[model samples]
Target: MLFYTVMKPLVQVALRVFFRQLEVRNPKRLQVPGPLLIVGNHPNTLMDPLVVAVNRRDPIAFLAKSTFFQNPILKAIMESGNSIPIYRRQDVETGAEKLTPEQLAAQNEAIFGRCYDYFDRRGTIMIFPEGTSVQERRLRPLKTGAARIALGAEARRNFQMGLQILPLGINYFDPQRFRSDAFLNPGPTIRVADYADLYRQDPEAAADALTEEIRQRLEVRLVITRDAAEDELSQQVERTFGSHLNPDDDPTTLYDNFQLSRTVQQGILYFEQHAPARLAEVREQLSAYLSELRQLGLTDEALESGRQRPGTRLSRAAKATLRLVLGFPVYLYGAINNYLPYKLPSMVARRATKDAEFVAPIMLVTGMLTFSLAYVLQTMLVHHFTQDWRWTTLYALSLAPTGFYALSYWNNLETRVHRLRALRLFRREPARTAGLLRQRGHILQLLGEARAAYLAARTAQRA
Candidate 1:
């Protein structure tokens, strides 16, 4: 656990840099005492554990696949960080064969015993019940491993351990993107003592019941899409028009946006059931509208820009230009000093993995190495040249803050550039510009009508 203590603060800082917004709904759930088990949806590989672990007070023990222990360096790291490995069938199967019933029991019993001992110390453990990571909104069917572990650990002490299972929904706005938002929605604890009677009767049945309970709690907390097409439409609506719908969206926490996303998914399902034709029309039109914007080198924001009042528009333009001018020197300094470290990680990640879930962790691990080494090497060179420790320390300190500033500056600059493109298009092709604006307005009208109809149907059904 010495390794965990040393790395916890560093991981906390790294997470803050990686994600733009990390909001936790009902944060008090995390402060609950240990002998606790954290169960969460696995959307990003190694990122899932770090995101949950960094938020809590004490160290969390994780269950990793036995394959990770094959590598010498990773084995040492995992051991020091209090990780236990369990064999997976996919890793063991040599051909197109499968494991027999409860095939992993023999292999996992020792691992389970390790967990029972951990709970004896009143420690916390985290597990992904889904067993594997997949980068999608939909939660996969959970294995009974987490449920069984909780029950076993409790029974090892004859149900007097006071153990609790914490179910968490890890909601990601965009799993693969670099500065996307992540929301942690935690469910209430499931007391292990509540199942003591059932477990004593039939252990297997008790495990199944506990797993179903976990599934229910996690379902309510997550925004699960039915299929790929549904996911696509919901994301499109949320990205472009969500704010208009949830105008009073809470600025402090992302729970409001989470609610909006869940509502949007329900709306999609409702339309598909009640008026498939209308839904299809909307989908087609939305696709066409987006295609037109792409061909015209514009975004939804650009069309919205055309509607701004002249005085407000000019003031906004002047302010954007001033920000660009004033922030240029800092941006340049950060780019020159930090660009190599940032770019190398992404390049390495892309080359290393084809799986969507693996991308984030590879980039994260690669970044941890690249940035640490680059900063130390660069700082030494600066010290050698300056012969002044104070100046060198100051330069070292400025690297991270300026790096973050550079990122923000570049993102805002892109927004300004897109708006300017809209202005230029209006001046150069007035007829085409007006046509696109009409198309956009029509799409919004269609969406508004559909929402009204859905609400009416929903109200009438309730009545």
Candidate 2:
């Protein structure tokens, strides 16, 4: 408990720095807690637990794969963080498989006993029902461990304990990207006590039924598609049309984006069932429109207001030029002061690992350490050379704000460059630009029609 209290603030700060926006929907639902079991989908590996852990007031002990405990440093950290290790058949190392079936059964029994004890003490335990992390738009078949653990604990106490299972959906905009967005949506709580009667009759049957119910509830909150190809199309549609439907510039809250994605998925399904030819034509048009945007280095927002008038284009150019002129001095200062710390993490990650899921966490941890160390070294060198503590202190303090300004300046610079290129294309390649605009118009029309049809069908079904 002491360790959790001490580390909670630090973890929250790290997560805030790592993700640009982390919004937790219906956080109040998590307050009615006792011996709570949190079940969430795993898309990001270690990052998933970190997200869930920091959101609530209660300290959560997670169930982690046993292989993570093999490393001494990591095991120390995990133990300190109140994590429980669950051994899996796949985690048995070759030539190091020491535990036989009986021994493994004993280990699991001990683990479950510990879980029951923890519940008796009114602690929260979080488990990823999917058992493994995969970066995809669909949920995998849920394992029965979560349901089993909850039921076993309740049954052990004669169904008197108030144990509840909370289902959470972790939606990541780009899980492996630094400064990306994530949304934590909490579903309705399942009362373990309510299932006691069923468990009393048939344990296995009760576990299966509870698992399926949890799966159904979780599926509603996630953007699950049929396959990879459909998932890709749904994502593309969301990226293209999301801004129009959700005009909020803040990326911190992703509920709106998730709704837009769900709507797109529904539209895709409706088209496949009712209007295949129309769907095929629209898909081709969307593909071409996306290709043109890529070729011209443009975004959907650039054309959100439709084809720009000549005066509006000229006004935008003049405003952009003025911003460049005014901000150049600060940009230069920031770039000079914060170049190495900003670049080193990316370089290290590129050379370190090929796994996409591991890259973001690695970069975040490495970047935090690198920046802190570099600032300290730079401050000491300044003091050594000038023999002035005031200047060194000022330099150290200026590091963070300057780095933030540099990031903002770089993003603006990229946007300005893309806009400039787009303006040039608009002026010089009138024919091509016109054709692209026509394709955009067609795509929007199709989307509007499909959205209407989809909503109508959904309404009829509900009615």
Candidate 3:
């Protein structure tokens, strides 16, 4: 299949290169003898699925959106990759939506009949209970699809061989980043006996209960925190939980004196499902624990400050645009440059003072020599591979404009860094601990301005 041949290799290579700190706990909890259901949160669309498929031993058939089936080529790819198309309400035929209870029942029977067949053959299926992706820390109200499907399968077989639903949480540190931290936590399997009857009584309620159980497990396994105010803790709870939380009423402290309410802990679990490395969950826990420790005047100031939020100087729009248009290129360049050797010394000379005379000629010559050598080696490789003079020439020629532009951008960034460093040194700002907490509003504003400028330059370049 194309998945094992092409897609899997690409995914493996990409994952190996981009993800770090991949700690998978209780991996054996994923194994089940009969049909299995894997339910978890959805973050990055393809990335999450890819991560799961690449890491998981089971051959999982996912219920994907119907739109992927629109294109014949894409549909083929999905089918080849073991994905099933599920028509969302909007995508279904108009007459189908207005069907009576009996009609709806028949339709459900047909759709689930296919799922039952897959399970009968002893296969694994994946579903996103949240139904959609949310970038925030908290989980959206979950849908009952996973629970309903599991219950349906059990009912069909008279619970002869019950479906084992596995709860998995993927934690990410800067998920959007090219190279980041990802951790996979596999919790205990939810048995058919756990909520099968509940599903028959009230399927929706059963789904909620199942999701809550998994959510609770995730919270206990993942929260990290340090000292902060009650209001700050409350805000964090609201942001991470997406539920109204009151820190004042029976305040939940973390760890020792910190009592975290069951609801708050559930919120923490849901947050763990949002990002890998359980950073947000851990951050909140750490905040609560440290806050309590601070009240007792026992928290370490140095560690507390280190645990605070990272400041972003850029605006949101600019940051978003930068993440796409600039982030990848910057990351690639950094990766390549780190691997490439340079003639320059690693440590700067101790005698080199801030007021020392500039050395532009030396810098320019060094850059030129490096570029020339790199270009020569690239040309030779292309020539050897293609074995066509014209093809090699074309490939070499194509680099001119791109290389020029990249060099200019790199030089500009280099100059800016130098200037900022000079200013910092001149002002005698503290080296390790400096600056106030960054505001999200300011970051968004800066991003907006930068994006506008980039657009202007692009428009001018096109003209």
**TM of each candidate vs. truth:** 0.94, 0.94, 0.52
Model 2 regions lying over 4 Å from their true place: 1-5, 93-95, 246-252, 303-306
lDDT of candidate 2 vs native? 0.83
Q: What local distance difference test score does each model get? A: 0.88, 0.83, 0.55
Model 1 lowest lDDT segment of ten: 92-101
lDDT of 1 by residue, 1-463 (tens): 8557688888887888788899888999986898999999998988888888888887899998777777799889788777888777776564333445377666788789989889899999999889888888899999999999999999888999999999999999887777888999999999998999999999999999999999999999999997888899988888888777778998787899999999889988998888899889889888888888888777899779867887998999999899899999999999899999989988998899999888888887788899999999999999999999999999999999899888889899888888999988888998998888888778788888987888888899999
Judged by whole-model lDDT over C-alpha atoms, candidate 1 comes out at 0.88
Candidate 3 ranges with C-alpha deviation above 4 Å: 32-34, 93-108, 196-463
**What is the number of residue pairs that collide in model 1?**
0
Best by lDDT: 1
lDDT score, candidate 3, position 439: 25
lDDT for 92 in candidate 1 is 55
Selected candidate, larger TM-score, 1 vs 3: 1
**Alpha carbon lDDT at 7, candidate 1:** 84
TM-score of 2: 0.94
